[model samples]
Target: MAALAHRLEDDDHLSDADFIKISNLIGQQVGIKLPPSKRLMVEGRLRRRLRALDLASFSDYGDYLFRLDGLETEITYLINAVTTNKTDFFREPEHFELMQKKLVAELIAQRRDRLPLLKVWSAASSTGAEAYTAAMVLADMVAQRRDFRFAVLGTDISTDVLDIGRRAIYPAEQVVPMPPGMQSRHLMQARRPGARPEVRIVPELRRLVRFDQLNLMDESYPYDRDVDIILLRNVLIYFEKADQAKVISRLVGHLRPGGYLLLGHSESMIGTSITMRQVAPAVFQKT
Candidate 1:
């Protein structure tokens, strides 16, 4: 019965009004057009938002959002509400493995590269697992190297999860992929009396990360630093083709010379002139 109750939490259904209300709201804000077929997903994301915001129904919230003048706060609430953060520490081993051998050593050897930064913007960084995972990779690589230099920027649209990111804590299951040797060096495990398995990122590795808010569709982006790597993973599948192209163009525009774009294994930029050439199954290099 207890297991059944937990399963029920993942199961959600949206009403017609809610389907339209959320679809239009997200579309207007982030330009993500939610179609009718995705109604249930929108409902699931919004359910958490509704509970957190203490709103009764989609219609009521919609009216409130529509009437609201300052959109930043409300937008922050929506970003945190809509996205799912189900990531682990070593979720993608290949990319990190590559960085360990080539990127890390090179960055470390550049003695004159002061203020040098290597960033892999986990654009959809949810609960910060992905960003922290990347941070772990850099930390491990640079810890023994004498002249190492790096930083990771994790950005997301969700304010709620961003809060979780800043908190830098996670349940045991979510942090499992990390190995024991690296785990101790990278994460600070926490388990108070009668509490469950939880972990927080330690200060050393935490300093290497800077998390912030980002909207993929926004034209006037605030970031000016050139990124060495950009991880716009499975999140792009949610956007329409034209929107995907637009976002890719914007993301690629920020990549540094010879930097890489690491995408989800299933995502692609088949026909876009984002100036990136495919390097592997889901990896691309700026041309």
Candidate 2:
């Protein structure tokens, strides 16, 4: 058995061909094209996956992933583990400013069930700040009205972050950079007082948002695009152009005619999409 395993180890590292296979699988499966710049990152994250499965080397693990009888569950971990998820309350503040200052005014008047409800979708809402920010905006909208219905939906590929999102608990440090008014209105410092200091969204605002796990690469995947606003921020940098087109097209199909799409400042629709028109820096509208 020891000799058999030694043979499977075959060398200390995966070959270049093996790395390409892994890259193709990620691109084909998750819509994320891993550039050569990510070589070190891939090796670091997948090394754990290899050892966890008792595989001796990455080559063995690659074969195991593609085997006809193998379970595909680990593939998700492969995607989630590699994706960057840096975000916070209004990381790109201008987009949210547009939603509050412009988009809401254009929405038909709020009238109970018939009220022009605001639905904001945070497409790559990792951890939860973006989603919660949307919820806070809508709740403030409601507080000004006699009656209204508003919803914020946040989706991501990370099961781990989805769990945190649903719980709506955040460390106090995560919120320190937010402005005083927002920090006070939407959050409450937790009771723990000392150790790391926790903070959580206030109950009323917490009730307005929901979270789910979604993969942009799933062809049959559907997004609830009937929203007043959609925030697909800071996430498209991982996808190549074709994948971006496919995901953007599908996402736009769900938007209400006058709805807005907000991309990361560094992200853009490129030349492939005709469904939206540029409205401002990092903002687009589908009409």
Best candidate, lDDT: 2
- Position 125, candidate 2: lDDT: 92
Q: What is the clash count for each candidate, in the order shown? A: 2, 2
**Given candidate 2, what's the lDDT at residue 193?**
79
TM-scores, one per candidate? 0.82, 0.84
> Which pairs clash in the backbone of model 1?
79-158, 80-158
Candidate 2 per-residue lDDT over residues 1-287, each given as its tens digit: 99876555544566688678778877877777787888887777777777788877776776776664343777667777777788897787887777778777766442235666778888999999999887777677677863557888889988878888888888888887677887889888866577678888888887878888898887755656477778888888888877888877778777788787888888864522555778888788887
Model 1 lDDT per residue over 1-287, tens place: 98885566555355566457667778767766678876676666666676777766655566556655534557666755665556666777777777677655543344357545566678878778888888888777666763556778888777767788888977876777787887788777665723577778898878878889888888856775478778877777777877888887888888776777777766765434456676566778776
Best candidate per TM-score, number?
A: 2
Off by over 4 Å in 2: 1-13, 50-60, 67-71, 109-114, 223-225, 269-273
Query: What C-alpha lDDT does candidate 1 achieve relative to the native structure?
Result: 0.71
Which parts of model 1 are misplaced by more than 4 Å?
A: 1-18, 44-75, 105-115, 191-193, 269-274
